[model samples]
Target: MNENVVVSADWLAERLDEVTVVDVRESWEYDGIGHVPGAVNVPFDSFRDEEGESESAERSGSDPRDAGTLPGAETWADLMGEAGVSADDTVVAYDDTHGVFAARFLVTAEAYGHTDLHLLDGDYSSWMREHETSGDAPDPDPTTYEVRDPEHSPFVGREEVEAAIDDPDSVLVDTRDDWEFEEGHLPGAVNLDWRELVDDETRGLKPRDELESILDAHDITPDKRVVLYCNTARRISHTYVVLSSLGYENVAFYEGSLTDWESVGGPIETES
Candidate 1:
């Protein structure tokens, strides 16, 4: 499986024994309803900072952005350890609600320079339907995991996003729903809902040819530097993973999405 890409259910089912699967649902969903057999339960919130919020123009250092902040460095490592994840392990993450939260986990992992991470294709709901053996995943043996700044990172800070807005060759995509896009969006952003990248029936990413066709029709070409954002950045990261898998090497995601944009009083536009 390609690291930092989406993995089909078939690809994952065949390699379950070889990789570590992380379920990013909350405690109630995981410990209550159940999860993929042998999957580790890593609630999505673990990666976000509950205390330290991100900076916005309105609050500056005072108000945190709407998106979740990263937890402390060692704290991230411990969370991985609790899931029995080692630095070398090929990890796959999923969530019941689309791949939003799951993608966040992968993005956070990428920030820490974790390699070989994948998002399970289809939402967790479909996976559970087919697998049917949902229950508590065994408590994983603790292991040491390291967090470091990678030589190259996939995140786009507010400053970089602002720069991209002015670069003619760059494409900034707003990955929120149509209603949200109509309500308001960042300046010069093209609206492309996150759902468009995946098949509704299968909840799996569209084939490359199909995806390319759609993107070409929308003027989202691979040649341009791409930046994505949503209200909370989760949807943006999901699209980021899909685009990266499609060989988009120069892509980045704005962690502070529209809400953050609004927070800073960034210029916005709406449909007439």
Candidate 2:
């Protein structure tokens, strides 16, 4: 049980039987193409239930919040159990675009006391690339799962963010598309679109050289309190995982992102 990180495909492949690879990509992604052999398909969308007057009930372009915001510890336990996972089982999560959903699953699993969680370095595309000759399509498992969580879990809120922003010592980042950041973002926020960081053509994170160049271009110093955010929260969570996996020591995700700010009547600036 790796409490605080993601693992590589080669490492996971060697221990496939010991680890449970859970694919959090959409049903269409799994249904249209294929998935890891013997992997479980859990839709990221089903991770949440809807609320009032919120168009977010239906996925939106700028929706930063994912259905899979880490729920209570009990809820987390139940989700894993239903997915045919035990607390002691090593779990690996993956998604199509970025690792955010997978990270969420990993973190939620961690919060639920299942520390052995991992993220596939890239995603389904990366898996397909490595196993060019393999085609293992998995049917979603039919099981009753329950996620349990400790009542008092940690959460990052608006006030804390505001304080951080005011502190001048914390580095706040918006991990969304460039257009979304340009559309309207928190003051002093820097843009690092998750897409540019990954190899779109290959469907994995950019090579080490490319990734280093990107970070270097951004002048992202190693020692800093890095706080990542997005329209909602999933993307940032993934970014947090990515940065952490890269040996970043102090990184955190703003769980309730821009939408939460807007919900609080916060101001937004439009591009001219």
Candidate 3:
């Protein structure tokens, strides 16, 4: 968890100098309005196609390629290299919805051995809330990340998940929306909407009080051995960072989520 995630808005604000903050929102958001100062716009969808192009169609459910079994390491490395991310640099990524896309960005970075990655606790909404009085948005420096080794991402295999299922202390968290959770989910998994992590109006993650309430409601304590998975694991990884921000320990993400679950012959159940 320590290697893959970073938490605390104050912690990120303090290191604004050393870290490269990225806005991984949709290209439309970047093209229409603007983005954070000194931050680059790298959408999570950027890694879908082979040449690092984004599919901007905005489909529901997670992308299948995000599963560990889909794309090859070389493909992902090329995608990161096209983005200009450095292995040595500390990266901070965020998006409109909690940090799902941001987590995708981080996972890809980590796969390439960019260990110093951080997800902005609440992301764009949090930034706006802190700078509400500020008027003009700062210009973003046009930059791209360079990928090194794409094969190094943290993706749990289906076998790992099956092993954990009966392990008693292990917890699987589903990061999809509430409706998605109600429809069907991995048996024994808990549902905590990723939105709960941030403030509603500003869209930034909630302060400690709100974050605490969310954990309390989900029965997620700091010491629990937790693993998060969503339709394809992108958003759940983002949720992992949020949980890390709240000081939850022993949290990890399943690389291939529901898609892989069914593929591996894992059972599922509707919420009763």
**Whole-model Cα lDDT per candidate?**
0.77, 0.64, 0.64
Supply the TM-score for candidate 2: 0.78
User: Model 3, stretches more than 4 Å misplaced?
Assistant: 1-17, 49-72, 128-154
lDDT for position 65 in model 1: 25
* 1 versus 2: better TM-score goes to: 1
Tens-digit per-residue lDDT, 74-114, candidate 2: 45445655667666666788887667678766655544555
The best candidate in terms of TM-score: 1
Cand. 1 TM to true fold: 0.88
User: Candidate 3 lDDT, tens digit per residue, 1-272?
Assistant: 34436555566666777777777888778656556556666665665443212221122134323435334456665555555555567778877776667777776666555667777666666666654212233443333544454343335556666777777777777878888888888888889877667566655566778788777778677666777888765677667766765667577667667765765457887873
Model 1 CA deviation exceeding 4 Å by range? 1-4, 50-68, 129-132
Which candidate tops lDDT? 1
Q: Give the per-residue Cα lDDT of candidate 2 at 228.
A: 76
Candidate 3: residue 104 lDDT (0-100): 71
Evaluate model 3: give its lDDT. Answer: 0.64
Higher-ranked by lDDT: 1 or 3: 1
Lowest lDDT sum, 10 consecutive residues, model 1, at 58-67
